[model samples]
Target: MQLSLSDKFHSEMARLCPAPLPSVLAIMVSGGSDSLALMMLAHDWAAEMRQDPDNGPVTLIAITVDHGLRPESAAEAEGVAKIAHDLGVDHVTLQWKWDGVGNLQAAARAARYSLVQEWRRRKRPEIGAILVGHTRDDQAETFLMRLSRGSGVEGLSAMKALPLSHKAADAAGAAPVIRPILWASRADLRAALQARGMGWVDDPSNDNEDYLRVRTRKAMRDLAKIGLDVDTLTRTADHMARASVALWARAADVARDVVTEPYPGILRFDLTRLERIEEETQLRLLAHGVGCLTQAPYRPRLSSLEALAEAAYAGRGATLQGVQSFVQDDALILVRELRAVADYECPADGASAWDGRWRIKGRRLGEAVIRPLGAQSLAALELPKGLPKTAFQSYPALWAGQALVAVPYLAREGLCAPQYDPSAEFHRSILSH
Candidate 1:
């Protein structure tokens, strides 16, 4: 069954943005057929979606990232910009400045998303999501890349249709990224573009076999001879994505049942409940708990996590992934390592992210370093009522030029909340797979 361009476009947009579309949306156009096609389709789809009573007016814009790695990059960005202009959509070309280069692809991707996000924060804060053109071919390539690296199901799931964060910023707040065109094939997009009398610029780097993606692209052609084509790989990735979701759901359920925050910056999982779940889910639950405490972007390596799980299963204690874990009284206690936790500069007023785990807000606290209540602070001062001495060192405290001024969660002096929520962060991790 063949679907028209409009049909595919509308279906993708419907799945990605069902109702209540943002007042403004963005498409990343890299002068590629897939991205250009996405820009064209999204422009029309946004207009159509806006007509619904439940949805509002959507101003679609195109963004071109010029990495400046190659001489033709600027021209390619201009080419995309020209198309965006012809399509009656606003366009902006952002440049990536680099003094020296290593891992060009990764650097470019990070810079591109960072630039786009910065633009959104400055010009269109209403833009909640940015649409990226990641066709099925890209997904297949990603799957192969991860597979070659011995990745697990989560990694094999490849690029998801939506990610909570683009991983563009190290900070707690980052705009969501959506791959609305993942269901479409590159051929379909190019054919649609051709039908519309549109052309695209081919990046030379894509043909450079030195790159993993280029090599994988060529390898996929050979694999297609044996029926291991893009369709097959993409189907495998889709299945893995579903499996990943179920696994995450199970882990989240386990977390809800057993995980408890006995004190600020501390997570305790019931050993009985932890031992009951399957080993895989147990690892996931523990990893997620640690991730929430440390606010690290990625989980510990599966092998490392497995070792930690083994120790936990045996009622033993071990620390991994910036979290210190120990067993005490039928509970697996996990706390952020005071030595490992990064200190964040406290803000004067309003909310500021501390160690990417907690948000602190107060007045006249700017210039202070928010850190864990370490041995020195715990030894020198008195804690609030009902605060246990065992948990005293784990609490977050403000240190201003060696003066311990405030401990928010423990007292009325300041306000603090864990930035990472168990259920929310768990679902976010699944979505990003």
Candidate 2:
């Protein structure tokens, strides 16, 4: 049976945003048909919920990111804003300009999400979820792209509606994001907009064959002639996602037996036990350790991870993905490379994270700052056991200008103490993804 838009949307919302709904929800509107339909459907769903006396008024905010890539972007953003206002939802627009740093499309995507996260943090901390308009089409396209790259289980698994993507930058208090429309097809979305007598801006870049996505989109029809349709790709992605979850759970369990944290940021593994694990589990565990240390959302390259694992098995030491792994004393030690964090610094405001892993907190000296416990800082101090001196160089220390105040992990008589640990994150990340 064909369900009404209200029915379909309400069902998706119930699945994505469970009861006692968030007070504020952010809907990403890019002025495209998919996003426009998402905004309209969200409004209808919110209205349906509000009709029940038991429900409180939910704030629906439409946010448009003006990437400034097209000349029509500003006008399109305003058009979205007008529509949002008509739906009785508050609207805000985020602005971005290419600094010519990297790939324009990739950079634009990362910047868009980062901007929205920052906005939620500073402007609306109450926002419970940021909703995006990724559809079945996006999932299929991403699957093909990853397939071309020879991506394995995790990468091929594609996107999930819940739990903000790990590829996304980590935000402390930001709302969890939901792609509630992933089950919706782009054609269906445009149909909904057409039924409403509404229009959407079509960015010319979508037709530009210079981009890989456009090329992929064009190839979909040819592949479909051979029975490799969107449904086939999406189903394959779903299967991979299911397999991925099981694999992650297995890795988490194995990690408990083989991994330990002698210090906050450092990961130590039982070399003998690690060598006995299945190849898949070994790679998953090593990836988790390196990911936690580097705080990188994406896993290290497959070749690099495999090479490092081979080296560790032979009792050799090498660095990859900002983590230095060496076999020592019957253990495989993974610590942050000293060179990776040499110039890393943040104000000692007690809130700044050092190396994106540890938080160091203590007394506030004049103009205090948090930086690595380099050789110069460790020169006069008595060191601690359980870790090499080179490893300590990347550990955090508090300094007031030139005077050293404390080393959080080392020489902590009256100095500051370690406030965070990456191994905890390693264990937690497996479940969330």
Candidate 3:
């Protein structure tokens, strides 16, 4: 069968990626029509480039992620692997182990990326990029979803052809995700597959009414009643995506100026400077900055951002989504872990505990002990016979010669449980720089 569109797509891929084709390129093939079509296109591109004198050959690896929501998911994965083998492409199946905790979709997404990133790190650390097969229809769906959720320009812009960078450096390393078929439509991809006589597995969940995508897709079909076409939606999404890029670039510039990293996992911002920026810009900058710190793409609620901005302006404290911001002296501290001080059991002498950058020493002293104390300290003078469960839970205890003295700086409460005078030698040892 003649595949004109597939051949054209393969040519486009060559023009986009250029030379030095990565040693190993991963194709996220879910055995669906779109992804399967993408795999075939990529395979053809690799073969053509290998034959060309200008571009060298590249290896293609097909990755199928099994969400395991259905009983046939494992079998589906096997089928995908078989197809990959038939196409002479390496295949790997990443099985999802859902713990049944948080949002199933969100968790599954995270898990999928984690597995792909880990595999790249271990096997092909030098690989330049991973390819995903998100079409124009997918982009339109994303744009509509964000619009329905009251998203800003960035949200509405949806997925990019390039891989999104990690918000924070602590997150997975920087590897660009390349989407080769972003410009292609679902119908076009389906036609390409049909033209090539390629078959794909149909995912039942895609049609299930319970999913937000399914519902939105149904609504989109209904939109056709009003003479709205999928092509129009796709074009609008494309325009919005460009606008989002410009807006995000501006926001990033503002964020770079106001946000500072004084400590690990801690962000500090100048409220006075923030207040001078325009209201919309301020909101966008704050959202972008916080999202960067959290390495999460989903922006916090508008209400949360407003409250945070208000707190920064008023020199108050505000907590949202496990992140806390408080005004301290002249600067605003954005703390990731901001919990009330609690008691902890101290470890014995000649031991240590690591708390971020600090290494705390624990040493028992007959008459004097050195330790860091924050808010939670023993009200009495003498040490209790046994440590309270609360105190023990707060700090990991260390023992030295049958005596407990210091705890990690993070366990400030427990370290000060049996308080000694500041002049004590043991106290000096634990607190010494």
lDDT (10s digit) by residue, model 1, range 201-319:
88888899889999999999999999999999999998998898888877766677777776556677788988887888887887777766776757778898888877877987777
For candidate 1, the lDDT comes to 0.75
Q: What lDDT would candidate 2 get against the real structure?
A: 0.83
The C-alpha stretches of model 3 lying farther than 4 A from their native spots are: 1-4, 163-171, 252-268, 328-331, 338-433
Every model's TM-score: 0.85, 0.93, 0.73
Best of the candidates, lDDT: 2
lDDT string, candidate 3, 1-433, tens digits? 6556666687557655766566678888888999999999888878877888876678998988898898999999999899899889999998888999998878987888788878888877776678888887888787777788897665666466653231222223545677888878888889888888888888887898888888888898888688655677777777877886676566566766676654233456777777788887777766654553344446788878998888778878777654556676556666442242122223333222222112234333333323323224433223433222222222233334434444443333454332222211111211111
- Total backbone collisions for each predicted model: 0, 0, 8
What local distance difference test score does each model get? 0.75, 0.83, 0.64
Listing every candidate in turn, what is its Cα RMSD in Å to the true structure after a full C-alpha superposition? 3.9, 2.5, 10.3
lDDT for each residue of candidate 2 in 1-433, tens digit (9 for 90 to 100): 9997668878888877767777789999999998899999999888888886767778899999999988889999999999999999999999999999989999999999989989998988888889999999999999998898999999999698874333343525456778988888899889989989999988899999999999999999999999889999999999999999999988888988899878777788898898898998999888888888887768898888899888988989999988888788878889888899888888766677777666666664646788777877777877766656666777788877777778765665365655674333666566665
Residue clash pairs of candidate 3: 163-177, 344-414, 347-398, 348-398, 349-363, 369-427, 370-426, 370-427
Best by TM-score: 2
lDDT-based ranking, best first? 2, 1, 3
Stretches of candidate 2 off by over 4 Å are 163-171, 364-367, 421-424
